[model samples]
Target: MKVVIYRVGQNQYATPVESIQSIERMLPIRPVPGAAAHVLGVANLRGSVIAVSDLRKVLNVEEQAFTPESRLLISNGNGYVVDEALDIADCADDAWEHVGEQKVWQRGDQLIVWEDLQA
Candidate 1:
């Protein structure tokens, strides 16, 4: 299956590229009070307010300063976040075999968290 690979913490994870809406750079985020620490804040994405989450913080990884490579990967019905959006790659279903036994999280029975890219 084709997937959009990305980096988070110290590992790589794959999400089907078809679900991605867009990849954007860091924009001004309005801090939300009384929200989860992982919630970076919200930003206006082309007139639509989007919630931005810190992948590192969310995964309990060490915090790192945002660099030019840092990006927001909006997916899963336009409501998702990833660390650095890596290039899209085509991988066969067999290729995913290596991902076995990793922490996988299901999203609506459609997507699964392959692995922590930071690892």
Candidate 2:
């Protein structure tokens, strides 16, 4: 399967490219009171409003200050905040050798979460 690899601090995570609507630059986010810690806020993408979640917080990775270079990954009206957007690459057959029923995939030692973000 093809996926876009992104970094959360020093760790890496991958999500299917088909599941992503678009990758955008860091924009102003309106704080949502009473929202989850990982739920950063809402932003106007194109013309639609969407909630942005911090992948570092939700995925339990070390939190790093989001810089101007940070990217917003939107899927199903919801956005995921990631440190850096890496390349889109195809996974080799051997890479999926140990994956089970979990929505995540194991590529060597890295834990690749392959969720259908739209759902």
> What is candidate 1's lDDT per residue for 2-118, written digit by digit as tens?
677777766666767666777888788888898788887788888998777787886677888887888888764233355577667676665443345664433333334574322
**Prediction-by-prediction clash tally:** 8, 0
Report the number of the highest-TM-score candidate. 2
TM-score: model 2 vs. ground truth: 0.81
lDDT of each: 0.67, 0.79
Give one digit per residue, the lDDT tens place, for model 2 in 20-113: 8889998889999999999998998888889999988877888788887689988777999988987788986456533565455566677766
Per-residue lDDT, model 1, residue 51, is: 74
Query: Which candidate ranks first by lDDT, i.e. highest?
Result: 2
**TM-score of every candidate relative to the true structure:** 0.76, 0.81
lDDT of 2 at 28: 89
Q: Which ranges of candidate 2 are over 4 A from the true structure? A: 97-119
